[model samples]
Target: MLKFDHVSKVYKGGKKAVNDLNLEFNKGEFIVFIGPSGCGKTTTMKMINRLIEPSEGTIYINNEDIMKKDPVKLRREIGYVIQQIGLFPHMTIQENISLVLKLLKWPEEKRKARAKELLSLVDMTPDYLDRYPHELSGGQQQRIGVLRALAADQPLILMDEPFGALDPITRDSLQDEFKKLQKKLGKTIVFVTHDMDEALKLADKIVILRGGQLVQCGTPDEILREPANEFVEEFIGKERLVQAKPNITTVEQIMNPRPITIMSGQSLTEAITLMKQHRVDSLLVVDENHVLEGYIDVETIDQNRKKARLVGDVILPDTFAVEKNALVRDTIRQILKKGMKYVPVTDENNRLVGIVTRTSLVDIVYDSIWGDEAAAE
Candidate 1:
């Protein structure tokens, strides 16, 4: 619900911070602006809330020019968050979150209810409402900063490197948490970051900038698969480039669709027969409807042949499975980390659809490493 039409920001001595940028953001989009330092990504975002006013062209939020609106009123309608997480140390968490509501003259009880509700959104308990900012950890305080922004239930939120100051682990956690929160709340977010991985993970659309101008703007997959030019290619890095090859991105593209399976009610003798017939050591167990139940292996069948009658009685129900649409890279990571031989692929309803084996990943890994050079030879 935001549009930048030929927008530019020129500072004193006529140095343009943002150069005639034109972009439109849809409702409920998670848009990230990213580039090298001093590339004007921050300035572009600040101009949205009038933190830094644009020098040329027009910025419209919901078709209304921001310049015509009162600055304070406009800011209250849009949420702003920063890396420092400016939660007032003197104010209690409840007071900090309810600041906007109080400024709007909301009733005391209504404000408290709003504060409590906002706290719950971030997984904070109501008891935290009475505590001061210093009592919480950095991550908690940052979460509070986000909650305060959401406190007013605004449709648009501007975030300027909100997770940059935290440690890598905490930063990664917050990125995932915020991405999920954005999807659940469906708030239009304009996030600014220097980290490409973070932008790729969190953004619905990425706006890349260079020398205060729009270089390229596209979804992560689009930019990764086909970079606009050498500059964009260098910015995305060679490792990411190889990993995001369009042909082998998703599990569905590489997984074997016809995995050998045995019915859960089938006898252990039949399970062995099926495994031998497929020339495989293990078989995925499924119900009559093709819904995945678990798995049975030659070893398990051999060990329990005399004791267990049906495959269901000896089946191992803790098999790991990935959804068909999961990224192959992600599935590979999980497979390696868990030391899995193969992973079952399932649809949303957990019906067995395909399987990804370690053997299947060897070619992908080789291709990612050698790239087109190997194919050309």
Candidate 2:
């Protein structure tokens, strides 16, 4: 929806902040600008809404040059949110949020109604609308700041690290909430952040810049699997695959869902029979409840072949474990940390659902990047 065409910006002191940059932001695409502090990302963003006019080229919004439009009118159409939040201390939450509407000369009743709706949309309560900005938590205040920017009902929004100041947990929580809000109200967002992880998590298209120039722009997976250059590779690191997501991969998706099973009190012969029938190595015994009791692998059964003990008698609880919906990296890290062969997959209530062995993870990674048929070949 917005395009920066060969835009260049030089300050009065003759320092070049943005070097001839040509970029296009797709409609409703959550694009992120990331780089070292002096890389001109901030300058590039500000120039879009004419907060900082280009010294050379121009920017366009829907084929209309922004330089032609009145700055105040252009700003009203493009929401602006900065790191400081800049909430006016003198006004109540409702008053602060409704600042744009009031300025637009809307009726008092209309402004008040909009104030309530926008506040609620950002997940803040109506009761807080009467309260001052100082009365709310840092995160709450930041949320209010976002809501206020959104109140203008603009087609484009520029957010400059909206949650950069919060603690990790708070920042993560707000990012999640913001994601949901964006889905419900699909506005074109241009966000600037130093946090690569946050950018990876949220960006539909990530724009990397260095030394006042564009480096690369692509989807999260694209950057993760294939970085543009040596610098991009060194910057992103090998952890991108793991860092791109949190605990979301289903246990069943990465687990050996079907394992050889022996009855609660089955004999060693039964253990061997189950393993052979399933063409597997172990006999996993579970009671009627489906809770993981224990396992008797082929090695154990072979060692005690002459004894022929019941599966329960030979079962060992030491090898059992459960981690549900764990990230593949987390799963492998925990498994390697404990020096274990397999980890069970359980629901939130901790009942066994499946088992994730080292084999399962490798298979999953292989199947995902390369096709299943390709892997088979």
Q: Which candidate number maximizes lDDT? A: 1
Candidate 1 collision pairs? none
Per-residue lDDT over 86-178 for candidate 1, one digit per residue giving the tens place of the 0 to 100 score: 999999999999998988899999999999998888888999999999999999999999988998899999999999999876886787688
The per-residue C-alpha lDDT of model 2 at residue 142 equals 90
The CA lDDT at 301 in model 1 is 80
lDDT of 2 by residue, 105-140 (tens): 889899899999987777677999899999998899
Superposition TM-score, candidate 2 onto the true structure? 0.71
Give the clash count for each candidate.
0, 0
| lDDT agreement of model 2 with the native | 0.80
TM-score of 1: 0.78
- The lDDT of each candidate is 0.90, 0.80
Q: Which ten residues in a row have the lowest lDDT in candidate 1?
A: 329-338
Write down the RMSD of candidate 2 (Cα, Å): 9.3
Model 1, position 241, has a per-residue lDDT of 77
